[model samples]
Structures are given as structure tokens and as C-alpha cells.
Target: MKEQKGKQEGLQHDELGIKIRSNDNPYLSADLQKKLLQPRKLSSYFIVLIESGTITYNIDLQDFTLTDGHLLFAMPNQLLTPPAKTDNLKYFKLLFDENTLALLPQQFSFLVNPLNAQTIVLDSAVKERVIKVFGILNQLFLLDKQETDTEIILAYLNTLLSELNSAYFKNREPVNLLNTNLSKFIEFKLVVETSLTEQPSINAIAEKLALSTNSLYRIVKEYSGTSPKDYFINRLMTEAQRKLRYSNTSIKDLAYELGFNDPDYFSRLFKKSTGKSASDFLPRQDLSGE
Candidate 1:
């Protein structure tokens, strides 16, 4: 993947607050392609569906190889390194900020839990439909200004997201979301993500959720297959890796930015969680040689 500074992350933006760029469009200029070849944090939600290509990119320090018929996602603040050199790399990318997401119905809960799986392989059936939808979206994206463009584009985008949400969890174990414990489990994930920097006590989080400490532990373990403290530590380590790879921030400043009062303790925790010291977790060439 390509490495570059953060400010170059947004290759396309508009008053509609959404951007779509694809190999299918003539407007995909060489300048935009160069920008995409850098390591940076996206300031908006990003979705990429690969139709026929094999490429490797790093997302949050985890390298993902997206081949033909694969879909990958990254949320705001997550680190992304552009794909390493490749041949026949055809894909459609959609980037939209929170303001665009807010325009949709609230039923799209899948956005909150995207980290559960960053990549998924699409079967032929799903791939065909997805391609059709992307085609419509690309058309709307390329259209000249019109009063209804934004609304029509948003509608297509909403449909695409709805389809993706269903496919995202299709293979995972089915859980009754209406069950109280399961509902609380979802809430726990939200709480952890929102206050990750603060590193609040598990007890404090449980209290805020009106959950007893033991109940909180049980819910987290059952849903995530890990203890609450371990989950928080993992999230912190992931963020630390992102900073180390993409930002020029020093370790101490990075620790403070993540709400750690003791940089030393954060360092120790990071090493223990990832088996790599902060300085050593930097990006390397994609093993596949692109």
C-alpha cells in the first residue's frame, strides 16, 4: 500500500457531502489515483467493492487482501494505506461523512458494529446485484448539478447500505437482538468505542449502562468472546498502531491524545496487547509484493 500524510485523504468532496470514485468513470483522474496511494485516516465512512483484482491494503494495521468479488470497509479515523502496485485493479469506492449517514433511516444499526468484520467475499448472486446498484450510484455521482441530485443519490446510497448491512451479519451466528442481554451487548460496544480514549473503568461503564458489574462481564464475554477489559485494551492498541503508522506524533503525545495520563503504562499495555512495541509496529511492505 502507498503511504502519505493525512491531509491528502479526501480525493473527492462536494456540497452533497458524499463522494464516489470508480475505475468505471473517466473522471477518475491520475491526480486522484496518486492521492489514493498514500497512508492516511479517512474522515468519512469508506466502502470498496472489488470486482476483478487482487490487491493488498492496510486497515488499522491489519493487512487485508481484497481479491475479485470482495468488499471491504473502513470507518472514520481508521488508518488506510493505498493498495500496493497491482494489475487489473477494478473497484468502486464510496466515501461519505456522518452528515450523509444521518440523512438515512436510523434502522441501519450495522454502521455501529462495522469493525466486527472488515472484509467479506461476495458470492455471484450478491455480486451481480451489488454491481447494478453501484452502477446507478456512479451515474448519480457523475451527474451535473440538479435540484434532485442529492436526494436521488442519497436514496441509492441508502439502498446499497441496507443491502450491505444484511450481508455483513449473514454468516455470523444469529442472535435475538431483542433479548435484553443482547441489546445491552450492542450498547456496551457503543460505549466502549465512544469512550475508548478515556479508558473508563469497567465498573463505571457498567453503571452508566445500568448494568451490574457481573452482568456487564457476562454480556461482553458472551457477545464478543472476550472479557470487557481485554476488549478495551485491544481497541486502544488498534488506535495506537494507527497513530504509529500514519502520524508523526511522538509516543508521549499519542498516549496523551488517547487519554492516558501515564505514557509508560500505555506503552506497556500496547506491547502486551500486540506483542510489538509502539515504535516497532510501523507499516512494512505488503508481504504479497503487490
Candidate 2:
């Protein structure tokens, strides 16, 4: 069942919790495309592979322009704004929820995005393989739910994610799950995301992760290129920017809502982090516009 919640259209599905769309086959209607162009929070992990042509997407307030063989991914709860026009784009888009991910035998670390890069540029060899996998999955999804073998679908899905995970980390240092420091860093990031509103102290976070403050500092710096305190502050500022750009919340209320004791201090920190005051940072045009 599809659900439209406020300005965000929730892409809910049935028990399978999966959907696929392509340029020609299973085409997207104009009305549905228009709805997708609006800024909305996605309830499922979204992936788009651009076979040809160009399209610009605004994801979490950042604009990314994708061309041939370019792939863009957005995690659940991210605000996405599709391009206004798709004149010549040939693409395959896939949406699946966390439930689908849990069924996979192995974990995909790129989903957590430790590298912080959303767009992946696929080389010729990898691009051809990816297209074949997406084509197979698209054909499988065309079958009726009752007739479709769920196991086959899962197998293809696994292959697609494996290809993506490998390409995502292509030239970068491989994500080694066995590395203790990397594992700790991922855990640290998860904790910060879940407890951002509390403005948890660095010492508290280190203790919770079962690492001393020094170890936490080293781990965070190695992965994120910043001190632990700066990383937390940057995360808070990013959330603040998202709220300021989307909602009509006042600065004082927003500051308090973000767990700041002093609005004035929050204002100063915001400026220091973003180089602009909160009032000046508000979007000139409402991103949720029709």
C-alpha cells in the first residue's frame, strides 16, 4: 500500500517490500513522476543506475548530477528531490526496505557509507555486469507474486548488492569487517546518529562503545578525518541545516529541540560550523513546492 504522509510520500509496498521501475518497461506515469520530483523522505533504500543521459538529484539538501554509468543511492529516511525533467534518461530504479536487506546472508558495509560518497562511477566492465543483473531482476519482478519464486529474486538481489558493494569501494581501502578499529568506528557512527538529539558527551560515547576516550579519538580521526568532538558537532549541524531548510521552526525552538541549553550559543556554533547564520541559511524557495 502506498502512503502519502504530509509532504513526504512514503513508498510502502506489500509483504515483499520491494519495487522496481525502468524507463520503458513498467513505465512511470507523469503524475507519479511528478510526486517523486518533490522533496520527500523515503522509507526504503533507493538505488538508481543511469544507463544514459543526465539527471540531477537533490539528496539530503546536496545536489548530485549523474551521467551515463553513474549510480546514486539514498538510505531510508533521506530526503530526495528528483530532477524536474527526464527527457532522454534511460535508467533503472530499485527500492527495497530493511526487511529485504535482513534476509541477505551477508552484510553490505557500503550501505552504512563510511566513505561518505553517495554517487559511484561504474567502469565499462562493471557497468555491463550491473546492467545485466538489473535487467534480470526487472524481468523477475514482472512476474505475478504467486508465480514468482522468492528464492530466485533474493539470489539476484544479493548479486546486485555484491557488485555495488565492490564497485563502491573500488579504489578505496577495502572495508574489512574483521578490522577491530573499523568495526568500532561504524558502531560509533551508529550511536551518534541514534542519540544526536541528546547531544551526548564524547566521554559518554566512548564509554558506551567500550573504548577509552583516546582510542575513540584515534578511531574517529582515522575514519572521518576529524576529532570526535568535531565529528559530533558536524553531525548536529547537518541535522540543523536539514530542519532549517525544510521546516518553519524558529531558531530558538530549533535550538532547544536539538538539546541545546542556550539558543544564543547554538546560533554561534551554527555560524562557526556553516559560515552562515540560521536565518540566512533558510532556503529562498520551498523545496516541497509543487
Compare the candidates by TM-score and give the number of the best one. 2
Spell out the clash pairs found in candidate 1.
3-39, 4-39
Residues 1-290, model 1: lDDT tens digits: 02322222442335657778787563334567666666776789888898887877787767888888899888776777766446677888888888777665434656545336778778888888888899888877676544344556667888888778777778764444466887898788778778988889999999999999999999888767789999888878887887776567888999999999999998898888888888895654433223
lDDT of 1 at 192: 75
Cα lDDT, model 2, residue 201:
92
Give lDDT for model 1: 0.75
What local lDDT score does residue 27 receive in model 1, on the 0 to 100 scale?
34
lDDT of 2 by residue, 1-290 (tens): 12212212232223566788786474467677655655676789999999998878888668898999999999875767767656787899999988778766677878867787899999999999999999888877764545655656767888999999999998776677667998999889778878989989999999999999999999999888899999999878877887787678989999999999999999999999999999986755744332
The residue pairs that clash in candidate 2, if any, are none
Clashes of each: 2, 0
RMSD of each: 7.7, 6.5
